[model samples]
Target: MMASRATARATGSFAAYTVSELTSLIRASLESAFGTIWVEGEISNFRLAPSGHTYLTLKDEVSGIRAVVFRGVGKRLGFCLENGLRVVCRGRLTVYEPRGDYQIIIDALEPKGIGARQLALEQLKARLADEGLFDTARKRALPSFPQQIGVVTSIAGAVVWDIIKVVHRRFPLADILIFPVTVQGQLAGRDIARMIRELNTQRTSDVLIVARGGGSAEDLRAFNEEQVARAIYQSRVPVISAVGHEIDYTVADLVADYRASTPSAAAEAATPALTELVNRLQSNHTRLAHSFSRLLQQWWAKVEALNVAGLDPQAVLQRYLQRVDELETRIGVCVMRNIDRVKEHVLGLCQGLGYCGPTKHTVRLVERVSHLTLRQDKQIVSFLETKSRAVESAGARLHALSPLAVLERGYAIARHWPSLKLLRAATDARVHDRVQLQLFNGCLLCKVQEVQQ
Candidate 1:
């Protein structure tokens, strides 16, 4: 505070200026003297503040200048600032009244050479890489066969067309959904990032491919932008970054699950080749056929080596039929013997009841036996009638299904003479040739006078 007062007195303006007035006057003088000056220096002690402003020291060989980038101006600076980076800044000078210090207020910053963009890129890589965004552990492998492939690229560009062509050539069954977004210019990054987030909400793709054709670094800046990089990192589906030629690289490539050299290569990586799949299927089929053929041969050899005492399949079947018939005969004989025994028991019970009433008992037993006999006869007759009716119904159904039924509808069947070949059309019978005609009633042998179509 004493130095400020002494400095003001030495300048002969102590009585004329207050502390705030002196600082303001100096700030105005500096601004008027150099409204906007360009300075080239190497940045040192660069730091970003919580307030979104930047604080830095711009130094040349023997001198250094304290510089500040306010939050609003700092926001528009495209590249990040770092120590040791040579930059050209455009800004005016201003004085801080309390501190009584003059510093350059930087409005814009640009790197010293073509390597400026590279420095920005390296800075970004270091940042996101530190956050583990580029870690191999976060990367995912693509599906063996993607059912639905979502693409983020410019629909009007050749990159999308190339991708479609390659994907179809490799696996025609794969479904492709293209989310056309800007791939260049200032707004491109935001558009691309939004598309990715939107696609995640849809969850429609088995895999995603973000691609753009090869171009200049500036033209491909969207892929390098932080928004696009984070978007790729946060994607739900595995993303393949195919942004440029093999020689080019972007932050997007680093954050993506897979990095493809070209758009077509990305498509190729996402799907299996159709021809190779077909070949594999055919190989499997052949192996299965060979296995079944060998199995059949083994069983046939076992069959040929077996001997069953001159019994063939037909003889074996006949033996089984004979056994069935014998079982049926024995069952019938057993049933008849049981019936006779039951009748005898009944007769004995009636005779033992009363010897004087033996004649009446005998007569009663005879009547009961006659009633039982009549019931048996009626049951047999009913069973025979049922079987006969079933046979007649079956015969009627067979007649209805037969082609001979067509004859009953006044249709006749004809065949060529001696050939026994049924004639289907008039042209089938030649003129003056003998023909056999079959009707519902009988057959007729006749000579054809003419054949007409």
Candidate 2:
């Protein structure tokens, strides 16, 4: 205490300044002297506090100064503060009373040579790319005919109207649902990401279109945000990104399943043209009808070429008649041969009796032979009558078994027209089908106007 007073006396003061008092005076002087000045330096030892304040060291070759980005200001900065990045920041010098040190309280900051938003977009793209969010294999195919399309964009903007107009013009059958969200400013990214997650949860749409009008990078900053990109990546529904013009590319564009040059183009891609679809259906129907007609014509031709005589009952009956005639002729020949043999044997027996002279014994022998001849003739006539009766009976049975007999009884056989398959029941022939009726004489082709159960 005595040495402190001695130092105070040597400096010509009644009392020494406390640490807090000195720090306060320095803070007031430094802040007043360099109020909102721009400084260009490379960032070092960059760290973010739990309170959202960023603490970093800004330095050149021979000098270094402490810098702090308050939460409010950091939120507005478009890029991340990283080590080794040369930046030009606008801020006022402020002394930290507790630490007895000074730092620049940054209000705005930018990269030394490039825009902050661009650099941030590039950085985020690289990060998400490393995680495979931008892989072509992970991309999904858009539904060719989406029934319902979910649109995430600003309701007040013209982009949404353009999409609605184009989609309705091309495919009036598709329905459009609008999800309103901010498309610019600091909170825009958060709003977009929230809506995307909500849309995925409900899954009401077949496909989604996240779009915005053409603008500068700052205006379209929401789409480049990491959260927005991730929300699109995780969406179950396929996403089509239509942000800015064709020349402008954002992180959302890279991560989406499809990218369109404009909102109108996105709508065109999401749905098919109504006229084209109708024409395609009509063409297919015509082709199917022609094919069916050609097949029916071919079947009809085959039926016409079929030989009806092969199924004729007269031909079958003629074969049976020829067989009967052959059997009758064979029986007649065998009967005549047996009669000749019997006559020869009777003559030989008469010669062996030695009746050469004209005597009573010879006359008696002649009488006996005459009696035997009459008896043999009676037996032959009975046998011939029995054989004729048997032949007639066989012919009657053969005629009874023939199909012509059934047809003659007024029973007709029905067969399918083209296929020639026999129809047993009424259901075998469909209504409006042609059928063939086989009668006793010939086949009759008739059309079945109706079918009975």
* Candidate number of the best TM-score: 1
Residues 345-447 of candidate 2 have per-residue lDDT tens digits of 9988788765664588778999999999999999999999999999999999999999899999998999999899999999999988999999999999999
TM-score (C-alpha, index-matched) for candidate 2: 0.53
Per residue, candidate 1 scores C-alpha lDDT tens digits across 1-453 of 557777889998754557787788788888898888899999998989998988999999999989999998876765677799888989888787789888898888888884656776888899999999999997998999899999999988899999999999999999999999999898999999999998999998999999999999898999998899999899989999999999999999999999999999999999999999999999999999999999999987766655434547566679999999999999999999999999999999888876656678789999999999999999999999999999999999999988789898888989987897999889887789899999988999999987777
TM-score of each: 0.57, 0.53
C-alpha lDDT of candidate 1 relative to the true structure: 0.90
CA lDDT, every model vs. true structure: 0.90, 0.91
Model 1 earns a TM-score of: 0.57
For every candidate in turn, the CA RMSD to the true structure comes to 34.9, 40.5
